[model samples]
Target: MSKVRAFTILEMLINLTIMSIIMGLIYFAYASFVKQVINYQVSIDEQNELTTSYVQLRTDFFNAERIVKSYKGFKVIPYNNKEIEYKITDKYLIRRQVHMLDTLSINKLTISSDFNIITKEDLITKMIVETTLFDEPIEFVIAKDYAPNLKLKL
Candidate 1:
C-alpha cells in the first residue's frame, strides 16, 4: 500500500493570517508616502506664488516713469497715460488701475506687507518692498534706470 500526505486546516489558517499582515503593512507604507507627497506639493505651490508676485513687481518698478507713495500703497506711473496702483488693504496686496474698479490681489497666504519710495532726482527713484509669508520675511529693492541731470538716460 502507498501513503499520501496533505495540508491540515491549521496550516491553511496560518498562511492566510500571514498574508493579511503583509497586506496591512503595505497599505500603511503607501498611505505615508501619499501624505508626504501632498505636503511637498503645497510647499512648491507657495514658493511659485511668491516668485510670480515678486517678478511682476520688479518689472513694474523697473519700467515706471515715476513712483509715488499714497495712502493705500503706491501709485506707479508708466510711460503711457494710464495709472496703475498697488494697495495694501484687508491683509492683501492689491493691484488696480485708476479708472477701473477691477483689482488683482495676492493670495491669502501673505500676512503683512510694506512699500517704500525715494525720489533720488527728477528722473530717478529708489523703491523697497517687504512682505511676510508663513511667518517668514522677504524683501526686494528696485532702482529706477532713468535720469537726465547726471547723464543717465532712459
Candidate 2:
C-alpha cells in the first residue's frame, strides 16, 4: 500500500513558527501606527492653541495706540495715555489697567496665552514676539528699522 501523505511534526512546527512571526510583525505595525496617530493628534491640538493665542494677541495689540515695553514675562502697551500691563503668571496672562472711566481703581482680567506670536513694523522698526505653549521661554527679536524714508544699505 502507498504511504499516507500527512504533515510531519517538523512541517507543522515550521508552519506554526512562521505564523507566529507574521502575527508578531502585524502587531508591531499596528502598534506603530497607533503611536503615530497619537502624536499627530497632539501636534494638531498644540497648533490650534497657538493659533487662538496669536489671534487674540494680534487683535489687542493692533487696537492699542502703542507698545510700551515687552519683556520675558511681562508686557505693557498703551491705549491712549493709560497703559495695559500683561503679566505672565503660572496659569494665565493677567492684565492690569486703570479703568478709563474710573481712574482711581485698577482693573484686572486674566486669560490664557498658551502660545502666542506678535509682530510689529513701520518704516522705522520691526519687532517680533513669541511665546511657547508648555512653559517654554518667550522670545523677542528686532528685525529691521529704517528711518522714515531712509533706504537700507545692503
Candidate 3:
C-alpha cells in the first residue's frame, strides 16, 4: 500500500483547536490594547482643553483694569465707563463687557472652572488665579504679571 501523505482526522482536529485558541488570545490582546489607547487619548485631550481654557482665563484677568470681589458668581471690572463681568455659569466661564451706550446683551466665551482656590504663595507681585475645569475637578494654577490691585476676598 502507498504511504499516506495527508493528516489524520485526529491530527486535523487538534491543529484546528490550537489555531482557534491562538486567534482568541490575539483578539483579546488587541482589544485590551485598543481600550488602553482610547483611555490615554481621552486623558490627553482633557488635559489639553483644561490648559487652553486656563490660559485664556489668565490672560483675561491679567488684561483687566480691575479685579473686584465675586458678585453674582462674577468678578466685575470697570473699564472706560463700561463694566466687564467674568463669571462661571452652567459649566462655562463667561465674560460680559457692557460698553457705554451699547446694548445690554452680553458676550459669551467658552470656559469653565472648578473648586480651586487662589493662594497668595502663587502670586509674584501679581494676582494668581487658580481654578479647575468644568469637566474635571482638578485645579489649575494661573498667574499674570499685571495686577489690577482690586480688593477681593480670598
Candidate 4:
C-alpha cells in the first residue's frame, strides 16, 4: 500500500512558529506606523492653530488704539471698546476678551518689542512673537507706527 503524504507534527509546529513570528513582526510594524501618523497629525493641528492665532493677534495689533504690556503678555484696546488681554506662558497663550477666550498651544514663546521712544515705557512700535514648531523656529513681528502725538497713548 502506498503511504499518503501529509505534513508531520513537527513540520506543522515549525510552520506555526514561523507564521507567529512573522505576524508578531508585522503587528509591531503596523503599531509603529500608526503611532507615527498620530504624532504627525497632532503636529499639523498644532501648526494650524499657531498660524490662526498669529493672524488674529496681528490683526488686533494693527487695529489697536492702544497696546499695553502686562505681566506676561500684552493688552490690546480696540476702538470699539472691546479690550483684549493676551496672557503668555511657556506652553500656551490665552487671549481673553469680554465673553470670548482663545487659547493657543505652543512649544515655546517669547515676546519682544522695538521701542520708538527713548524712555521705553509702553512705546512699543513693533511687537515680536517668537516660537518654535517641530524644531523649526518662527517669528511674527507686528509694527504699528503711531503719530508723534499719540506715542504716550500707545
Candidate 5:
C-alpha cells in the first residue's frame, strides 16, 4: 500500500481563521477609503457652492445701477429694473429676487463702504464685501459711478 498525507482538521480550521482575518482587514481598508472619498466630495461641493455664490454676487454688483443698504442686508438695483435683495446672517447669505431665492453658506461676512454720498446717508457708492469661504478669507469691492442725468433714490 502507498502512503498518503492529508491536511488535519485543526490545520484546516486555522487556515480558515487566517483567511477570515485577512478578509476583515481588506474590508476595513475599503470602508475607510470610501469614507474618505465621501468627505472629499463634500468638501468639493461646498467649494463649488461658495464659488457660484461669489460669481453671482460679482455679476450683480457689476450690472447694478445702484446698491443701497437695507434693514436685513442690501439691495441691488440693475439698469433693467430688476430688484435683488441680499439678506445676511451669522451662517448664511440669502439672495432674493422676483421669483427666486439663493442661500449661500459662509463662515463670516462683513459688508461696508469706503465712503458714502455726503448728501444721502444711505447711498452706497462703493460696496466692500468681506467674507470667509471654506476657512479662507476673501474680499470683493463693487463700485458704481453715476451720471448727472441718472436719478437718485433721494
Candidate 6:
C-alpha cells in the first residue's frame, strides 16, 4: 500500500515566509488608511472653526447700531448694553465683548476696511479678513449695514 505524502520542512518554511510578506503588506495599507482619515478630520475641524468665527463676527456687526474707528480698532456699543471691539495685533485678530466677557481670536482684517478719518463714526463698515488654517490661506470681505439712528441725540 502507498502512504500519503506529508508536507516537507522546506515547503512549510516557504509557506510561512509568503504569509509573513502578505501580512506586512496588509499592515502597511492599513497604516496608510489611518493616516488619511486623521488628516481629513483635522481639515474638517479647521473649516468649522473658520465658519464659527465668521458667523460670530456677522452677528456682532449686524446687531451693532454703529461702529467707531479708533486707534485700538473698531469699537461698537450695542443696544443690548454690550461693548464690542475688534483689533488686529501681532498677526492675530481679536474680538472682545465687554459685557459678555468673551474674548476670541479671529483671522486678520486687511487694511481695506480701515478708515482714513480716525475720529469719525462709520455707519457702513467694510471688513476684509485674511486668515490661515492648517497652512491654507483664506480671505473674505463683509459689508455691514448699520441703523440710521445710530448717533444718539444729545
Most lDDT-accurate candidate: 4
TM-score of each: 0.64, 0.47, 0.56, 0.75, 0.78, 0.74
In candidate 6, which residue ranges exceed 4 Å CA deviation?
1-5, 98-108, 111-124, 133-136, 150-154
**On residues 21-131, what C-alpha lDDT tens digit does candidate 1 reach at each position?**
999999999999999999888878777776777787677777676665666577778878567777767556777765654333343322222232243323325655565
Ranking by lDDT: 4, 5, 6, 1, 3, 2
State candidate 2's TM-score. 0.47
- Model 1: ten consecutive residues of lowest lDDT: 108-117
Q: In candidate 2, what are the lDDT values of residues 1-154, reduced to their tens digit?
A: 8999999999999999999999999999999999999988887877676565556555556555444344433343434555666555444554556642211111222222212123332221333445564445454333332232333321
How well does candidate 2 score on lDDT at residue 134?
40
lDDT of each: 0.63, 0.49, 0.51, 0.77, 0.76, 0.69
**Which has the higher lDDT value, candidate number 3 or candidate number 6?**
6
lDDT of 6: 0.69
CA displacement after TM-score superposition, residue 46 of candidate 4 (Å): 1.7
* Model 5 alpha-carbon miss at residue 125, Å: 4.1
- Residue 65 lDDT (model 2): 45
Which sections of candidate 3 miss by over 4 Å?
68-71, 75-85, 89-137, 141-154
Best-fitting candidate, scored by TM-score? 5
- Summarize candidate 6's per-residue lDDT along 69-127 as a digit string, tens digits: 66767776677766788776766667776555333344556543433243344443687
Q: Where is model 4 poorest over a 10-residue stretch in terms of lDDT?
A: 110-119
Off by over 4 Å in 1: 1-9, 97-128, 132-135, 143-146, 149-154
Which scores higher on TM-score, 2 or 6? 6
